[model samples]
Target: MQTTQFMITPASGKRLIAKALINYAPVQSALESGTLVIIAGTTNGYLAEEILSSIGQLEDFSREKFFRGIVLPPSQPRTENGRLFDESGFPGDVVIVDGKWKKGLTIFDVADDLVEGDIIFKGANALDVHKKKAAIYIGHPQGGTILASLRAVIGRRVRLIIPVGLEKRVSTDLDEIAMKLNSPGAHGPRLMPVVGEVFTEIEAIFCLTGAKAEMVAAGGVAGAEGSVWLAVSGVKQEVAVAQKLIKSLSREPLFSLPENE
Candidate 1:
């Protein structure tokens, strides 16, 4: 098999992920025939951008900044020195499709009417690679939207798709981490175990390039931090396609919360 390798910046990764989500057969079907609710985090914001741009609706939302759902550090980013979503929630940006109706409904409203084919796109804070599980951080006293969204996901069997990057990988067991983390434990940020269809850069490559991608190396400096170095294995044509697609997404703009909203 022909093998190809390259470095994918975080911004490019997000763009590839957005295209993958849009191309996913299940996501498209649900959006067309059923409900496809998107709970936007930083990464999912890119997915939203792809969806909007696909329909030529990018002008509807502020292209200047991303409307984020729940942001970690949930405080002012040290790098940007500005608060990212001062008061974030799961209602950041939703594409709720309810049969003949389509609108941006609240998480609570989406939760009540969820069904098996419905899709809940939620981002995570960390991923346990060894166990193949992901985790999210919760700060709300009531455990936030994750608590409520679980009911529909676990009870109703709705598809919970998490769009996260490789930069957030964790080494420990997510269950143990969550058990020890609680909002009242007097810690910085509480961890919550989330079970869902984990979609990371690995999945994005396959979805975007139709090639098998493996993480070979990671980490970089000089604006390359949070990048994922991947080794792709496939037919010659597939490898070339992968290369072209990745290069096309290399300059994706970073997702940021609105300066004033």
Candidate 2:
């Protein structure tokens, strides 16, 4: 097998990941045929922009300060005296059907019309690479969107697509971690282990390039922290294509957090 090594920066990695999600065969088909629900966060927020805007026109759809789901930890000065500014997900939801973005659709509204074959996209905070499982941070006492979406996704056979980066990979057993954590007495957010189609950068690269990519190394200093290093193995032509894809993403801008976030 042919092997090619790569060093990807964090921000550029997210862009490549976004590109893969937009071009994923199943996702593309689902967007065209079934209802697509996006519970946006920092990572999926980038993807939401990619889905709406064409390549080379990302600037047209990249600003979404209010539409992101983020955790506001109590350690931050923003959280004090039990006042939480946690907006871990957009207050609302976005839906797309027939390859067209539909506005003004709420998750509740989506559930009313949800059916099998439709897709629910949710982001996660942590992934267990060994177990191929993912866990999400929940600020909502009632379990938030994941729980609501699970009803339709699990019960009705709707597809749940989780587009997360390798940056969120965790070494601990997610279930074990969840056991020690509970929303009531937790100093911070509690985690909920989720069952879904977890999409990481490795999967994204394979989906986009048809090449098997492995995480050979990780972490870096001088602004490359949280970035992933991969060893992609494939035929010569496939490796070339993967290289080109990575090149295109090298200049991809870092997704900026909306001011006052």
Candidate 3:
């Protein structure tokens, strides 16, 4: 097997993950004949772009304000729900039904309508890579979109796909962390361990190029913060494909909030 290494910044990783999902079995199947809810989040913003593009309806969609809540630096102001204080331009979640983009709808609008074979794409704040587990941070009084998605996921057999980056991978056990964060006196956003297929950059590489990718290192300076160094190994052709694929996304600009925000 031939091995190759590539440095993928968080933005590039999100793009890569989104590219992989463009041809994902579940997503393709859902788009053809079922419902697909792309919950509003930073990472899912990239995914919404890709999926929309795949269906030739990329026009009128912008990732700039495609998030409900986001994590910002200490200097930035946030609401109790961790969203920016000014939530005026917040776009609703991307809900696509039967290959049509249902504008102005969210999980709450269609959760009860989803049934078996449908899919939901939600981003995560933390991941347990070894166990393939993921969690979301919730500051809403009621559980957020996750709670609504769960009704279809665990209750009705709809699929939940989590497109998270390797940067969110955590060493601690998610269930244990959830326990602490959900304790009576716990302060701050609570963590909910979610059940879903955790799709990260590693999985993106394999899914797109048939190469196995292992995150060998992480972290960087300047625009490379939260970057992951991946060693992709496979047959000569596969590694070559992986290299080409990574190159196309290496220059993806860092995700930034709209200037008006």
Best of the candidates, TM-score:
3
RMSD values, in order shown? 3.4, 3.4, 1.2
For each candidate in the order shown, give its overall lDDT on alpha carbons: 0.74, 0.76, 0.91
lDDT of 2: 0.76
Residue-level lDDT tens digits of model 2 in 1-261:
588998787677767787898888777778768888877566777677787774233343434443434444455665444333654533456677767676656566776578888888888889997677899987777887788899898789998888888888889899989987863566777889998998887888888888998888899886676778899999988888999999888776665545675
Model 1 lDDT, residue 112, Cα: 74
- Per-residue CA lDDT of model 3 for 87-141, tens digit only, reads 7787799999999999989999999999999999999999998888999998778
Q: 125-174 in candidate 1: lDDT tens per residue?
A: 88875555789877666877787789999899998988888888877778
Q: Which stretches of candidate 1 lie over 4 Å from their true place?
A: 63-91, 98-104, 183-186, 257-261
Candidate structures ordered by TM-score, highest first: 3, 2, 1
Per-candidate TM-scores read 0.86, 0.86, 0.97
CA displacement after TM-score superposition, residue 223 of candidate 2 (Å): 2.0
Candidate 2 stretches with Cα past 4 Å from truth are 54-63, 66-68, 71-91, 183-185
The weakest ten consecutive residues by lDDT in model 2 span: 54-63
